[model samples]
Target: MQKTHCIIPFEKNRNFTGRESELTQLEEMLFAGDQTTKVAVFGLGGVGKTSLVIELVHRIRKNHENCSVLWIPAINLESLHQAYLDVARQFGIRGWEEDSADVKRLVQEFLSRESAGQWLVVFDNADDINMWVGTPTEQGTKRLIDYFPRSKLGCIVFTTRDRKTAVTLAQKNVVEVREMSEDVATIMLQNCLIDPDLVNNKTDTSSLLKELIYLPLAIVQASAYINANRIPFSDYLSLLADQEEDVIDLLSEEFEDDGRYQNVKNPVATTWLISFEQIRQRDPLAAEYLSFMACIDSKDIPRSLLPRGQSRKKEMEAIGTLDAYSFVTRRLANDALDLHRLVHLSTRNWLNLRNEWDDRANTALHRVEDMFPRPKHENRALWMSYQIHAQCVLTSTKDREKESKEWYSLASRIGECCLSTGKYQESESWIRQTLKLKEEVLGKTHPETLVTMNNLALVLDRQGKYAEAETINRQGLHWL
Candidate 1:
């Protein structure tokens, strides 16, 4: 038996914490059979797919002394080719030294031999499928997948953010790496932080982890910031809570992480920004959905709230693209989609960076307005389900958009809903805003302005401000 030759690029993470179950599952699957096992580990960027794979490969090297291991970063053609060349050099494959020699083919041929011994190969960051399987028009060209060696003694693993790529690579043998559990995330944060005492306050620790969405990379980034600034968990949490911009600024702070790709930015925001750009290039409709979704509340988004696509099929495909990237998840009971909170913030920041925030927000406002039902007695159940989303849309409206007719209409509908539901204070606020706008744009004597005044008076009356309500009614009548 030949000695195991491990070719991992990154050192094993000594600070790696948790993911015991996932490690166990990957171990079992890799060693389950002799007939060339293949598994793909996939999830959102910065969810620790690469870390988990690294851990698994290290375990494999320790447990199987005779098995050779190879790590290839499939980030691009150059990286993959370089990794294959390195493997060729390690194996001392003849002719690989020549520029004309096909290093990939040489490595592939050597691994396919029966005497190559048991081997495990990991393709890290295989997020781009077109590079592996050429696009429709480029089918005649040789693809990266063609160079992958097949052998009964070999096990292959892929880490990716795109579920479609994962499925295409490994079919049913896919493991999704979700955000770490609270307990695991807390432990990881403690491990990452230089000062363990900072996490002594359990409440602050929990709040910090929750705000980071328990994603391993985000937790690590937060810990890095806290460690660098010599701040406590509460202080970092306060900064995160200050405002959306603050949160984005914090997540955008880059730091050195030994376990990650050297060329990649270590910030949580920038890590996911790569995935966002890929989604935009791969599926523009999904990109549009993401932009629009960023302007509204992140949770409990009814499918009906989305703008209509060219067709139902296209709409579902767009949503499926978002789901494939783990950016949005569907609720089992209601089928409503919920975007990850951190992803939501990152997306909004991305839009702002591109100077497209207002356009997307305006689109969201108009979509909500078009779909928002009147506050009629029969529409109560429907509007009730949409109430929070309506409020979110209204809150996201800029001062400039507040003057738009759609804005006034949505505001009035929401206020009417509030009035019908006996939320007198909120109703009065919305109706007052609408009345001010109507009076400015359409004049105080317009029928719509009178209607808004009447609604405001009713809300004031409901709140026991009869004197003010009577005065509003007289003013409306005098204008008429």
Candidate 2:
């Protein structure tokens, strides 16, 4: 595949992909003669947070022609301060440097002043939490957020991966971004790639593409690679199926013309690495937690189940650190703490490249199992909790095929845990759900599912529910 470097500006005429609702919500927030509202767009990296923000700016500029738009990337405190300086420069604030701090204060005050109607400031990618905790201007990134004066005349929007950051900044005004639907993905692919023919014929190609989870960065990388290589979409699919590492390697290849960004080392990979390395350096425990998380599927992780070495408290702290950096998201029970699949992939890639893949995975597995559900009648709640944790730990792991036995063991153990809890109905329900998913994804006869079925039947038999147990056993017998 040819190296791709320069990121072309998104086509204005092209249909904006996957954010119609978000745009509409933003429009509502900022609609009509300057009612000051702060909105935030936040999600995992590469979910197109920046793209969405850029597009929103264009829309706001075009439709609300009178409104001034100011954008600042808050990756760190200095960049945020520079943004203040830039805002000062834009306003032509003379002698602003005479009293820099006072000038900044005035700028904030002016922006929020009743006269500053129809102006919007977008704080893009404000991921760092320290930015929020300290004094808004003097200590950390928090000051910039605080600096944005609350005025009915002005509006602000922030984009970040950390839910906590969004809460700290915009609170109720935050919007969570999910993966794009097929239609949006198709539109995005069509617009981004060089070859129209391949996109037009994206029947089988689309199916293969879905496995990459429809993340904007992944789609962009895939489209760019396919266009540059002139490879048939089918061949590309074959390479992808053959090895994920191969696809990542191909993505990593750099284009000489584009210098760094255009090279095969995809933007997704590059930016993710920077975040990963930072987490590792600043918070090794969180880094370890993230590395373990990389071993599993990222879409839904249960916090109770994550591998947290010997110190449970320490693990929670580590998770907090990761959460602050927007590396990991805390779903907090309602949906099981979900991690972005792209983050999962990037983390695994980082671990494998650094030669810590096995160590991380094994440590995760060990610590996770240690926290697994224990079996006892009275402590059924505890058992169920542990069961959920173990499932999350196992599910979050990577290379399920290689760890088939471990998967089977974990699944079976969960089933056993459920049975022992005497929540027989709940046990049956849990086993049935696992079996249904396992049957569809892993197959009906996959040892894991079969074992779970047998366990479920055993639970039924133990409860003296012979008819139900017999029915389940009959099905398993056929599989055997």
Candidate 3:
């Protein structure tokens, strides 16, 4: 038998993803002084916090033979009490079951003993501070943190979505588990796909991983879908882009994880919906801001674009709420904020399920359209930040027909900016795209459509593609 008879059940497959740095950090914390023994791994739901902690569990059992380990589910007070009782039984503490003595208090004192050797206890999925610490009510007497056994002989690891609770529980020892690195994501994807592909397909595999946003849960889910349907990755990618509904459809399809995750079921979207609902309930503004962000691009969103001015302090604090939970990362250099791509899609889908997708999306588009600068040479620097965001938002939308018309102007402005900056190919592509949209949305002979056609021909001519340019100019002449 191993040293930890009461450890969390390790998955038989034993194929864990990245976080070598995190695992090492955890190992160091286990042996460090009192200031570091107890560590909290906190991040957005489905960001692999639990999986990383589970890996830590397996490592502990292997490296520290004298260490005692326990897994506790702190979903609520009752589960916590039950976990404490179970551990008490494992340690064989005297009279732990008796109503005469408090089981929690006794379990606490026993595990705090120096004889306990190097002990580690993991409290998984502690998503709520109120549940652990108990909000101000009659039951708020003792928090779960208060009952934890603290000793140099023992260490406690917590996995939570609540940063405040994490700070209160683990103090300075916190591991903010972010998304898996691209290389790690690629490895996970290669491992996840059941079907064999040609050796030359690695580039496509990397592309698909990027499309899945490098989130481990999303990557795993996509791979499972591919394997289950026996479909090629290319097909899944095509389906994924069919519409937001398709992405939602894929995300909501349930799969069995073979009991690896305790209560987190397979649907990647559902796992995040729980967090979405919680965020909505706790802070509606933050939730709205998230919804708005989903409408924008997922990267390098400047604080300048969000609601601002004299209320800047209040707005920043609201955004900070998201930063605290690892939903968005605030870049220190330019104060730009980036959202996880899957999280962005999931947020839109979360709203979609409620039939709020179009209204919300339209609102987001209008926000961007309102904020976007008109095509002018002086504002070129300002357009740089908004360029990618506009393209991302425009591309993510499935229904180009229902999109706000202002997007055309935005496109033209960005295209003109691209032209002036010597990005000829990009400029040509955007001009051609908007010209086509203008022909479709406004009839072929509409003055605006002719103007767009002329603009496209000009850019095409500028690119020295005379044949295409002459062809566009001829079509315009025929329409006029």
Those runs of model 3 whose alpha carbons end farther than 4 Å from true positions after fitting are 1-4, 34-36, 92-102, 134-140, 162-165, 193-200, 331-333, 362-366, 373-375, 387-480
Candidate 2 structure quality by residue, lDDT tens digits, 350-469: 988898876777666676666655466776665555555566556545654334445545555676675765667766765766676677677778786787788778878877999988
Local distance difference test, per candidate?
0.88, 0.67, 0.76
**Model 1 bad stretches (over 4 Å):** 1-3, 135-141
TM-score for candidate 3, residues paired by index: 0.76
Error of 1 at 304 (Å): 0.8
lDDT string, candidate 3, 197-265, tens digits: 521377677777778767777777887788888877678778778777777888888876653555656
User: What does the lDDT read for residue 245 in candidate 3?
Assistant: 74
In order, how many clashes per candidate? Answer: 0, 18, 0
TM-score of each: 0.96, 0.65, 0.76
Task: Give a tens-digit lDDT track for model 1, residues 1-480.
Answer: 555588988888999998888888888898577678889999989999999998898888889988999999998888987898888888888899996787777888888887888999999999988888875333343567777788899999999999999999998999999988888888898889898877789999889889888998888888888889998887887788778887788888988888898887879887888889889998888999999889888998988888888999989999999999999999989889999999999998899899898888999999999899987898787888788888887888789999899999899999999898888999999999999999999999999999999999999999899999999999999999
Best by TM-score: 1
Where is the poorest 10-residue window by lDDT in model 2?
Answer: 1-10
Steric clash pairs (candidate 1): none
Error of 3 at 319 (Å): 2.8
Point out the higher-scoring one by lDDT: 2 or 3: 3
**RMSD each, Å:** 1.8, 11.0, 5.5
Candidate 2: misplaced stretches above 4 Å? 1-15, 31-35, 99-103, 135-142, 200-202, 253-266, 274-286, 296-305, 308-341, 352-358, 368-480
